[model samples]
Target chain A: MSRNLFDMVWDMHKVATLSTGQDQLFIGLHLVHEVTSPQAFAMLAERGLKVLYPGRTFATVDHIVPTDDRSRPFSDPLAEEMLGAIERNVRAHGIEFFGLDSGNQGIVHIIGPELGLTQPGMTIACGDSHTATHGAFGSIAFGIGTSQVRDVLATQTMALDRPKVRLVRLDGKLGTGVTAKDLILRIMAELGVDGGLGYAYEYGGAAIAALSMEERMTVCNMSVEGGARAGYINPDDTTVEYLRGLPYAPSGEGFEKAAAFWKSLASGPGSSYDDEVGIDASSIEPMVTWGINPGQGIGISGRLPRLEDLEGAERDLAAKAYEHMKFTPGDPVKGRKVDVAFIGSCTNGRISDLRAAAAVAKGRKVARGVRALVVPGSKRVAAQARAEGLDLIFLEAGFEFREAGCSMCLAMNPDKLLGDEVSASSSNRNFIGRQGSPTGRTLLMSPAMVAAAAVSGEVVDVRDFV
Target chain B: MTITPIRSLAAGRGIPIRENDIDTDRIIPARYMKGITFEGLGEFAFHDARFDEAGNPKAHPFDDPRFKGGSILVVNRNFGCGSSREHAPQALEKFGIRAIVGESFAEIFAGNCTVMGLPAVSASGPDVAALQDLIEAKPETEIRVDLEAMRVGAGNLDFGISMKDSYRNALVSGTWDSTAALLSNLDAIRAVASALPYIGGFA
Candidate 1:
């Protein structure tokens, strides 16, 4: 019988069927970061336990790391303590540490793929919601909690109930100025934020097949926003080629063997799915979120939905969004004043994302009064951007080219929105207070759109500026 | 490190919040995540929703004197919608809530609650709405959640709720303490880790 990619990978990782009826799945890779792991490590200490499979785990600092300055003794005492705790915990447990000085240091999701650590047919777990980012490589990745983090560290296995598989196929060619970011925003809008509940979204079809490895990562990264436990694109030539020469990837003949195995993991022609949805890529335009949730989105040229346009609970949510975001119903998103323009996150902070934004920023200066920032997802992405002088292009455009970290994505660091400042952000999660302020508003858009907003100081259509 | 099993719960009052899709960010705003521990999270539970910009008290359900010590929370569909922050469940648990009955729950949030020994049971939309209405009308009514029978009782209303068999067995059998179970299977885990080339390469 043919099986989907999710079932194939999940079957490979199933360690045991517990008496509780959940599978004891062995995690092939466990990624940890500063913010969530400190308490987990402490939990292990309290239990007098050591990392049973330290070799399977890796640690890095990202969430609370200050993007502007990396000097020792961070301004925030809590941030400093969290970082210090992770450093000690990793060292004591004999796990690999991607410290601040390490060139490998970056967001856990970004570093894993760039280093060839994320591979097809593996189960990866991280103490972050965006761990779904690794599913781009055809692996089954999950964002777990601190206690589950401890479970993985101590046993390299996590108990989980298997999820049904949902096939989200996007066909046809994407129009110019449309990107993976817009495609995902469109998916979330069409399928409500909770649409993918109890399912693993398997992304396929012509449009998804055409996206680069980086673009595939961006699409998978936001699977959590759609409420999918995980999302993935099948491993094909694009995936194999992207992984070929990375540091941890197999070499030469070994690479050939690995590629062949990865090819076999793709969903077979007759593979079945619990549910399926198809999207016409040609119909999707540059999308933007106007409400407090990622699902409340509209095309850049389209007007915000009136209260009457929405039904039931959504209507109530629309009213709350209107009051919080200060967006007028039925008004076009264009020309809405933006206090900040941020172009970075694990979702769209890869080299290609920066290049796309740089193309928009090359000949234009940021509009006065807009605080613009471009943060790379990883140190390697930062190094690559600087090598190509994308950093200079952004800086010359009056955008702050900052160090690699989560940065303004969740704004755990100092790069936060003040008061009720509205921002055009190329990050995921537009939930209330998500950008570090209670009343602060975030409008999610593509990186190029965020750049256009920086140049125009409002939510203008990127097509106009490009 | 075993978590005490939570087999059954009986609460004198249930706090009802009619809003749908109450995300984790609203339960405990991201700013409060700066701490190194889950301690003291109770005070900050619903900190933003319950307080104003100037730190004044707001008219939130949690703040009502009638529901001050409510151990059961009744909410609308898609409760705990975003973020895998266990802090949301941690806050609810810290705020003295032992169980949650909602129209539905985001998968991760419910999982987190299960591990923390906080049972999150789900009922049909009309059943949850009826429970909320009944609770609001009579705050002194007793709300009972029984894991063995898989039912919720409030006054004359008896609503059958659904829970994954695994989650229910874990809670009833005290096997929900995942840390202990994980630690017990160390050898098998090591064998699996050794078989993976990616992990073996590290060694």
Candidate 2:
């Protein structure tokens, strides 16, 4: 049988086809973070095993480490211990380590690409689920558990059955002021969170092509929330340009040779898909996740969906979302007050994201009583934003400018929403209690929209601010 | 990776954490949610609330070192939820939790335990409470989960669990490489590779 692009990619990466119908897909690159890796490496140590491919794996600290007080021996004893453990683990194992002290440390996903480590035509896995963000470079990237992490460490391979690939074609064009965050939110709302179960999403069509590399990353970063194991965009010139000269990228003559290979990873002309879902980009408006889960969303101009307006699983989920979010049925999601606004995460914290948010928050002052904070996705992004005076603009507007890390996105770090505070956030997912507060409500939106909300103290459309 | 379903565990008892959708985050808060080793995390299990105002180990009934050897953790539905943090299972395993019974578990959490040689079981509400009562009645009681029959049995209480056959086989073999095993037979693998004739052309 003629193999599909996914099949070809899977077959190309397979070290061995196991008996149970799952292939031991070679992981071209593996990223480990402070929180999940120390223990896995410890398991290896107990067994007196060494990392099979140290050059292929990289390590960094993000979770738990205090973004602000990053000095050694962190006040949180556990944080210090975790960081120390990874430091020792990487050093002893001969794997690359990006220490906070090394200036290369950042969220594993963000720094991977900026440092030119994450590349195209490769299979990547990390302990963190958002690792799919690497797919913007046309790589097949996904998250795995610790044992799987250990498996990848010991053999540079992961075991897996192939998932059905669904081509999500976004044709037409995005209307002005609509961003990639909105594009993903719209996709999630249409598909619901569980829509991609047992599948990988291949984002394509003009809308995705029209997006910048960073923008495409913003789209793929949320695939996990929609229940997909992985998501990717076919590599193109934009991807090649993004990889032209990163620290780890092939140099000079190697670059041209690599581009040709990377370009071949795209679906062939007239390639058929197991499933195809098309969307008119112009129809997707600025979107925000209204209730819990990425699927519970509404357009900027759309009304909050009523429990009755939903049906089946959606209705039940929506009712729960409403009761938890304390939202009224049929109300406009716009203008809902927000106590906090977070403008970072691997999802929407790239340098481009910071620039876009800063554009909206430049002259506008934050609303009284709104505690807005901007967290750069990585130290590199933070340094770039600072170079452009974006950090100053945010600080002048009353938003606390912070260092790089996942921050409030998952509340693994010190920066987290307190008590029952509802936040307007640029990060993905609004699951109940996901934002630190057991009852804290999260409303997800684009970076610019989050900035606008920070200034207005409510969920205001960024177009008006623009 | 290995998945060794419990041959049987001495029934364990403790005060219920009583959280529904007790995500992997709460199972082991994101801060302690690091490291590759499964050992020693049991002490830090539920560390956020396990410690009191002074960071001292609160005398929560379950925090007693006596329950440290407890084998079962009874939880609400949709338990072991949230992001695919494998450390959650590591923490549970480190704490000497031999088995976990919930109404449901997040796909990744359930799979993580299966790959880690641990048993994250699913059971009915009444059955879970009965196990809880046995623990509360005698905190040191050993609860045994019989993987051979897929059931958790204690004094006067027995509850069955359902699992995928692949996962069951993995526990027995101590290797979740069912995919690899299926091909272990030379003839079967030869048949599979031959069926997909185009595979050889790729290399």
lDDT of 1 by residue, A144-210 (tens): 8878888888788899999999999999988999999999999999998889889999999999999
**Residue A358 lDDT in model 2?**
97
- What DockQ does predicted model 1 obtain? 0.57
What's the TM-score of each model vs. the native? 0.98, 0.83
Question: What's the DockQ for every one of the candidates?
Answer: 0.57, 0.20
Reference-based lDDT, residue A306, model 1 = 90
Residue pairs with backbone atoms closer than 3 Å in model 1 (clashes): none
Error of 1 at A348 (Å): 0.8
Residue A241 lDDT in candidate 2: 93
Candidate 1 lDDT, tens digit per residue, B57-129? Answer: 9999899987778889999888997777888899888999988999888888888888887899989989998
- Show model 1 residue runs off by greater than 4 Å: B1-3, B194-203
Two-chain complex of model 2, DockQ on C-alpha atoms against the true structure: 0.20
* Superposed model 2: Cα runs more than 4 Å off: A19-21, B1-23, B32-81, B91-107, B119-168, B177-203
